[model samples]
Target: MQQGSLARYKLYPSSLLWLDSLSQAGKDLRARCCQIQACDTDMVKGLAADAHRLLARGDASGGAIVLICLADRCRDAGELVLAREYCEEAVSHFSCYDDCRHAHNLAVTYYALGLVYQSLGLETDAIGSYDRALEAFDEARSQWMWAHECAKRMMNECDEVVRWIRELRQGLALGQPAPPLLTGTLVKIPMWSTSAGSLLRVREEPVDWVDVEVSALGLANFALLINGNSMVGLGVQNGDVVLVQETADWPADGQIVVVRMDRMESESVLKRFYRRQDHICLEPANERYPFLIVLPNWRLKEEVSRRYAQSHPERGLEFFLESSVHCVGWYCGKVG
Candidate 1:
């Protein structure tokens, strides 16, 4: 056997003590035992058997702790299904002793279950478990100082996680082309006053969601409202809703795209993307507006001449690919 495998199978002093005094062990010892079990995959079945025996001997708390340990071990090993099963068992056992005395343990069990669910991508279920954990921690706060601090920290963390999950769902909804179609709000792209032309500005104004038929279009399609008549050459007009297909893949040469320049600034524009041997060009449809270019090795905050005369000059505004300029998506077709 490999040295690492041998080390895992090697019995420690605490390993024997765990089997004999599991019921009397504190949370620290239970946690240590779990860590040891996680290192040695060979002993997992034996540990489960011992936990069952402990349950048979009327040591529900000890059995539950063992199961929780097993779950943590499985989770670390990427055995998600087994980890979920063990967490479910642990939750059941902890539920039986949901009194104030066992509140801390119950809360910890619920939190662990929540983590497992989160890892499995079950966001709703994870949020539910986190809520249960917070409730249990709330009840135990008076008894334990740590529980109060943990509860407070978890409350903030859970709120952020829930918000993130909602945002993620909304983003995914935008990419789903299934029946019972999804709707997206069309936000206007603000224009910035610049010498070159009316450059796009980033704004956070809220817009009402509008239902657009996207079942015919493939998944990953979104809607954006045209603000400027720059793309009037391509039959795209102001106030028209244009469908955009989201992708990280490079847009084909001459394809229209929604692009943002300078990550720090929220300014974005709809332009025809073109790549030269040395630089990238974002061309507007209207000849009245000069196109933007990012030169090689351009640094941030470096003043680029705002003058329209210097807009397409030999050495003008330089931007770094990916860092300074980002292509959000390719334009599909106008909706309305």
Candidate 2:
């Protein structure tokens, strides 16, 4: 929180100092909290009582500050939900304070909220919190570039390197020379299979997929595209091109699969396939959608049935190319 607030109050050294002092004191609350269960569970109780008294004395800011301390204590003890509730209450109580009227503080509150959201794998909310934090930094005209810099850094670390590779392979398969990049144009690469006697190709205006250079060492190149809001818990989202390769046949449960669902249809959705006794089920990453179940006696093709007969299949699906799937890894760019 202090780090987040610092970006919004570069000019107000004295105010920053005071806030930092309070933040440090909040840390002290943690030490006292450890003593509470043994010596006095009443320590936090006493603090809350004192905070209420402060509130009655027209010191709402002080009271809120104390609440923040208690909330941090809860967070330290891994009681995140409780911590978040108390932090929110603290922010609400101090929001109207004259001395605490600052964008930096507001940003800190949002950042703290973002932490809560992130802990629960609420990617959409976490992104919003980061955005609000940046807004607060902008409002204060802060000189600190940490927030923006962090954004840039994340992009650098986790950009769609795989998508670029997939586009390149797709172009090669289509008997077309690769362009500079495949991102600008959105082309749906058709799923093809000789074994299934399926040949589906729905081509549109070609996209110039980006070219990402892989490391010189043993890391093989791969690519995939992200679609839908599923996999948000894993920080992978729709429209992100992912890069992956064929490993061993053994994949633990909950492994994602870029499967060819419909051999007859021109397109197929990437689904996470879970194998159960006498059943092959397709699960989506997003909980909003229902999982698809295929019973053993279900009327799926006989050829595919025997192909997936084993409890643990000898080989997971293999891709002809290295970059076979793509996903927008998290941060769907929606704010609500």
Model 1 is weakest, by summed lDDT over 10 consecutive residues, at 9-18
lDDT (Cα atoms) of all candidates against the true structure: 0.54, 0.40
Q: Please give, for residues 150-222, the per-residue lDDT of candidate 1 as tens digits.
A: 5564444334333433443444346532212112222222222211124556456524333433222222235
In the range 65-122, model 2's lDDT, one tens digit per residue, is 6655454444434456765775676657645643323444554555455545555555
List pairs with backbone clashes in candidate 1. Answer: 294-319, 295-318
What is candidate 2's TM-score against the reference? 0.31
Per-model clash counts, in order, read: 2, 33
Among the numbered candidates, top lDDT falls to: 1
Worst 10 residues of 2 by lDDT: 327-336
Q: What is the lDDT of residue 61 in candidate 1?
A: 75
